[model samples]
Target: MLNQTPLWKYIMVLMVVAVCTLYASPNLYGEDYAVQISAAKDSTVDLNLVDRVNAQLEKAGIETKAVALENEQILIRLNDDSSQRLAREALESALGRDYIVAMNLAPDTPEWLDNLGGTPMKLGLDLRGGVHFLMEVDMQSVMTKSLKDMEGDFKTSLREERIRYRRVSIVNDVVQIQFRDQETLEKAEFFLKNRNADITIVEQGELTLVASMSETKLAEIRDYAVKQNITIMRNRVNQLGVAEPLIQRQGADRIVVQLPGIQDTARAKEILNATATLEFRMVDLDHDVRDAVNGRVPPGSELINDQQGVPQLLKQDIMLEGSHIIDANSGVDEYGMPKVSISLDSAGGSKMSLGTKGNIGKPMATVFIEYQATNEKNADGKIIFVPEREVVSVATIRAQLGSRFEITGLDSPKEARDLALLLRAGALIAPITIVEERTVGPSLGQENIDLGMQAIIWGFVLVLAFMLVYYKAFGVVANVALTANLVMIVGVMSMIPGATLTLPGMAGIVLTVGMAVDANVLIFERIREELRDSRSPQQAIHHGYDSAFSTILDANITTFIAALILFAVGTGPIKGFSITLMIGIVTSMFTAIILTRTIVNGVWGGKRLEKLWI
Candidate 1:
């Protein structure tokens, strides 16, 4: 009974193996090349749309394995990539912008397993082939905008508070209010300190109060720009029907976006960099547009060109910004004119209500702003981008607009839908320039998968052969555990939501194949040493396993710690490697010690033996 494993222990090990094997089974089913079609905001998606897609695909002479509408999206599964591309192109043209036609790799997981929350491990860009983008957030733009907004708010607040100031301007990213005297400056500084908790009174002179955003506030703004960009990119990716995208903050001012299975780099860029924002400002009826456009611009109004390049004067004060918009939908009005209905959050509603109440009969313009990156670099070696601002629409303020409003000057339904998509997806707080772009085709991804799989297979087979030839019966137990070790590794990887199977991750698995048997080697050698000292086979087996546990635990603990550090500090591929290695170390320890010991117990435990083979 020296080496007997309890019934409960056997049950636990069997249960673990059974579950891991079950979860690992889905990866064998592979994937289906498919096109996913989702409706735009206020657009309808139904069986009729599925029929339309099918007809279009058929018209293009592309055969689809199945065309179905599920979860408010139409999915067309094709036999191969050729048909997939053909079907996507045909459907996109037919469906138009009302539907988001995106290329996807729909998993061929069975209903039962899928319903049980079993999914194959997500593949990374290197393994699945897609686009990788390194985007840099414009932190300067963020701080500048923050300062401008604060200046606007301060000027308005001081006026409302009956505090007079000669000038309020932003100098060196600090808002300076120049008062008539020191008494008024002190009054303003005291009022500001009480009003806003995020501003610091840097220096107060005789007639000027210099205030800037506190370090914490500036940090929060920087974080907001980066994190908000990540969030919006995720929304755009979801809208584009991308599956398992990796969008994360890289550093203080950078982001890493990896879209797996996305072949269209242009589409990827469009989705990530589409920071179209809207600004509502009153058309300056008091200013002369001709004079402003020619040589003498007005004091508080700017000369802007409409979408048709017609000159117009507009107030510089923004009544509302698109950042406050919560939702937008494109629909036809009663007259059948295309329009976009907008919904604003509570703050925006209040601001719009206040800003438009006095301008009832005046016209307000919707200025569309799009940032474009240029090859020209700034003095700081950063790329410079131009914001092409155009007055898209001018509408009369019929009444005081609040949370709900409509803009009806859209030329077509497509334009209205495009505007709605931009609004609904949320605007990036600041513009992001693409510092780097890389595309990995599906063919290359498949090549990586093949090569990585070959590495793992070969390494695993060699380890299996070595154990079998050297330790015989004990080797047989380890080989079985090793197989289960692999199964459990895949299973655990699949179970973890964030785990991605990259090419480097496969290398981690291969490294683990050899390391998985080290504990077995220690135990078998220990048994051989004990047997040479004239111990019985059962005694050798018992002492061998019991004595090796501490060494195995110590060795594996150190490796796991190193892997943890790597995961903590690494990014992208390094993270993939570290995570997989960490998971492997854990699973290997279980398979090598617990699983192999249970097998050895069942096979040869408590039996009388004159000699030991291990």
Candidate 2:
């Protein structure tokens, strides 16, 4: 009974290997080129859209393997990249701007596996091929927006405090306020200083007071903008249905985004660069829109076009910005009409409640603002954002609306869903300009994958030959365990969410192969030492495993700690490496100790042997 294993251990090892094998089988099916058609702001994607897509492809003589409508998007699977490109071009030309025609790689997983919630391992940009963008946040716009908000706060605070001021305006990057007297200036300065801790307050002479952000505050603002933009970008990219995307901060004000298995650069760029937000403002019914259109715009109002391109006058003061919106969803009203349900934070709820309390039956306009990059580049070779504003909805307040409200005058369900998506994605703190863009072709990705696999295969072959030649029968057990270890690694990775495999991750896998065999080497050497002590085969096997347990634990635990640190502090490729390293350590430990011992026990346990193959 020295080398005998418990029945439960055998069952656990078999169950793990079987489950891992089942989950890891999906990777064998590979992927297909798919043309994805998503409804734009004004378009609808239903069965009719799928029919139209099929018709358009047929008319263009493009062959498609399948067409399906899912999640309000049409997915058309094609035979090759050439067909995908051709189909996308034809569909784009036919659909115009109503739909976003993008190309992606769709998994060819079988229905049974899919039904079981099985999916292929997520591949990184380098392995699967996609677009990479290096974006720089417009920190100047961030500062300007901050200054404008401060200017509003300053005016409101001064008016509430009964302090007289000629005017408060943001000139350049500084907030300038002209007070009537030195006493008012001193009082206002104290109030503003306490309220605006991020800004430095300066009194110019006796009547003018200027406030600007400190250098440290500016840096903090820029960093926050970059980080916030990264989060928003990640949310927006979810619309692309990417499995695993990389959106992280790079340096001070830049972000790096990599979208794997996406081939539509134009649509990806549009989604990433789009800076959409909603603003609720009072409809300036006191001002005549005709006069504003005639270039006689009012001082405290602005003329803007609605979604139909009709001009309307709106108050310059914003009641609520999109940033306050916490949740949004597309649904139907009591009359079953399409509407967007919106929820706001406490501050936004208070602001809305106060703003609408006095304006019962008054018209409130929901202004949609978007900042787009122009084709023109500046001297610094960065794209400039051209601000475009439009009134998307104008509705009369029926009651005092607070945190929750609905926009029911949408043109279609698609519009409602789009508005909800924009609200949920959250507005970017500032516009982002793509300073660098790169596309990785599928062929190149396949080549890299091939090279990585080649390295793994050669390493595996060399290890197998050495073990078989030296350890004989015991080497066969180690190789089987090694294979099972690899399977479990892939299985665990596929099971986990957001665990993507990259090139560096492939290197980690290769490294794991060597480390896994090293564990076996330690046990085999320990067994050899026991044999030299004149112990029987069963005694040697049991003592070898028992003696090597502590050494294996110490070594693997140290390596695992390093992997954890790498995953904690590292980004991008380094993180990829760390993830695989950590997973490999876990799986290898199980295979090397539990699995190999189980197999060995089943083979040679409770046997009286004079000599051992090992």
Candidate 3:
């Protein structure tokens, strides 16, 4: 009669089958030496662009692995692993043809992906060669948006109800409105509540109405802002060609972003930090900057530009701040001048509509940027106060915008393109200085890989010899499982997206190989003890596994806890080590506890009498 194998044996066989089937194929991995073409951020992308570009590459006899569209960017993979010239040419052609916004090459494709493909699980920056960014959210902007919304609602409701207010001001989180009397304040409060305004009346003095946005409403606004931040971060990371980046809230007003295998750290930083605002403001038809620079203006006032090609003079008022800008991009105007295309939100569109209505025939200057020259407050003193301001005009803005906007006095084409990328990403709150930067050249990575391979080979030889001697025949079974375990781990790693196999992580895998055999050692030793006590072969096998289960569980559980600790506290490569260590512990335990036992039982369970080896 056929007796079915135990549950553990079935699982082990299934795992062996899966590992073999998944990793044994050649085309499972991504192509080597491939360049990725992407879109400029905040710009729409056409998915069919990949087919068009691939058609061109195919003519060159280059086979592409896959064409993936993520975050509106098309990623093209091809052979010729180190053909930078070819990659650059292909990328530029694609960009010139409007197939992609930008193109870049990761020094190397992810090692595991190169051998295994099809949506591999991506690794985080800590586990791969990538960028880690800690970005500070503009809480002030969030609060300001809330205030503005509150003010708009208040003004609209007051006007409709005929409630006259002498003044309205927002200080701290409170909105203070000075009405004529207490009756007016009470009436205004009633009107506000009736209109369903999310405001709380804090004080109603003789002629003042103090109302504040509700705490719940403020919290809701903050939550909304956080959601927006996540969306923006995801969009930016995708555009940068990062695989499965992790962008999550670290604190109330901070986001923690982890990008894997991103070569351009500065570009990644720029993308994550940009606040893409697109605004159209009329040049102050009132002021002249040329005259002011020549000492024709008043004591403290300055000149600036509007959306149209004109200069204006007034108090430096940002009528519509960055929050209203929905999107922006760089393009060439009809005159072949570099210009930025912008889209406004409904409120901004309304303002723009009103500002430009019937004023098209008149001059309308677009102020591209605000330039404040760096100078000492007292001509060589240390104290730095924003010294002077000048508004850039439509023509100046166009010239300065670069590839995205051609700034008039760009030093070179490179400078123009860089500025264009910056604008597409968004404007920064302040200048972000790179205090630290390190580039990992391909040569360095290759050297590390060579050393890592040598170490792995040595480690495997050592573990195989150790297992062969200690457990004897049973030890050989353990070695087989260990070999298969290594293969499965590699296959699994390759299958994971963004999973980078760094040197430290490889070390973790080596360490796991020894640990993988420990469970088999425990079980085998238990079986030997049973045999020594004259137990039957079947009883020996049963008791061995039953007695060893708790020991293996406790040992692996402690190791898992340690790995988790390392993952939580460590950063970069150390964290990579922790992740691999944790995964290895799991896969090893499975192979040892399940796979080793089945082979042992099948081989030695019935034949071994106490006299054979004891």
Candidate 4:
């Protein structure tokens, strides 16, 4: 009597449960491993870099159960404690030597039941408890790049015109000039205008003309950088594989990324605070800085520091910049000097060829190696560097002439390797640092789960009590179907690959509980109307379900459409809400219509029964 639902309806419920069980089962079957990374204050994690790290973990004989990159943090699940430690060691080595921030192991997690990718459902940050971070884009880096690009253009223009100018540089967002009187400045401005149309010349005085990059150009550059940052951020996230990571632009120069389920605070810091911009400059050994300070360096070149820390008066002309260096890697020289192997594009290759060819046998130090360092400064704000002996030579560059070059200046054994890893990975151009950090332990997650379960239980009780009070026996039947419907929804979700359960998703489920019984309520009400209109109970039952079917279809169709649209447009929790709601609707329709109809037919078959109260 209790199992009066139609055979088809029974089959549907059983099939759903079976499929869910299958999906919720883990594939590995042996052990669960996990690692955590937390972004610290004043640091921003690179989601892409984190992925490379996880890959390294896998290479070290450990497999990842889950990798969740959270807001200002990262968390990973592995096979077991030993595996986790191995993974953590690999991660720490990578982060400490390659990236530019401080990270720690945080605290050890107690033995969790090996549920890596299991169906008990891991809660996201908002649902469970974890660190949340809001990161701002590096506008300073953007501005610096813009200035450098403009300066590069200025140099090119001067060289093309063959006009000898005293000095041309960017200072405070405006191009300044110290030319041979006002005539040379005017001529240089005119030449630059042809090369760059967006510069506006405003006369500061007779001897100087303040040239500003056009407002339109500036706006265009800003917009482009913001969009570029979004793509870069997205790539990083995809690499990290943070379940349902949220990355979007907050404003023109700020981005907001939320990584749920992260628990290590310090490790998160290392991933975010790196500015992986690599550059190559030849040492200007043709002149001495003493001459410049004493006003006798040279007419065409400026004095600059070389790889040996000695000042050389080299030509001011940039043979090849970092942008031309397509790739860089860390490697060892024949004599064991740490060096970064650099690769150049066609243009860079030609320039490097010409520059290195003429200066062969003569001294040429690689200039501007600041981009290679991990941490730029010490605690006291002084710059940090690996000693001179560790620095690589131009011969290091020559070995990989056409291919990618390795910067062997990496002092620590692992440093060169990690640097090579980052460069080959096409690391981020802009510097991003986490301005904040925190961690959420699994215990806190368990507490949230308890509370969420309590809420769900309370909600069901209230819904059941109300239904029974109002509709009596009909309400009881509908309530049973409702309960079955909820089970089906959960079961179905567990079966879908990307379907995750979150707090908002729980809200969707609760809302669906109310919706699941609508068809039953409508059918029962129709049956009562038919009975009152002089129809027998048997006739009432048949007509009620038959008539309600059309209405049920129309109502569910609209709600289903809305859920689909929500799924299409929404992100993160919103998408989770839509998915759960959609699945519930489908399950509710099956239970309420076919199950209720079958039960009613079984109860009052071929008889005009009275007294419907239970």
* Top lDDT prediction, candidate number: 2
lDDT of 3: 0.59
Least lDDT summed over 10 consecutive residues: which range in candidate 2?
Answer: 152-161
**Full-model lDDT for every candidate:** 0.85, 0.88, 0.59, 0.61
Highest-scoring model, TM-score: 2
Tens-place lDDT per residue, model 4, 562-613, is: 9999999887778878988998888889889876666665665545466555
Stretches > 4 Å off in candidate 3:
1-12, 15-17, 20-31, 41-82, 85-128, 132-134, 156-174, 189-206, 211-228, 246-258, 265-270, 277-457, 496-504, 536-538, 561-578, 608-614
Regions of candidate 4 where Cα sits further than 4 Å from its true position = 1-21, 24-33, 36-122, 157-167, 176-211, 215-242, 278-429, 438-444, 461-481, 491-500, 531-546, 549-583, 586-614
* TM-score per candidate: 0.77, 0.92, 0.62, 0.58
Pick the winner on TM-score between candidates 2 and 4: 2
| Candidate 1 similarity to native, TM-score | 0.77
Which 10-residue window of candidate 4 scores lowest in summed lDDT? 101-110
Worst 10 residues of 1 by lDDT: 267-276
Could you give candidate 3's per-residue lDDT for residues 360-381 as a string of tens digits?
Answer: 5444333344223244443433
Report how far off residue 128 is in candidate 3 (Å): 5.2
Better structure of 1 and 2 per TM-score: 2
Q: Whose TM-score is higher: candidate 3's or candidate 4's? A: 3
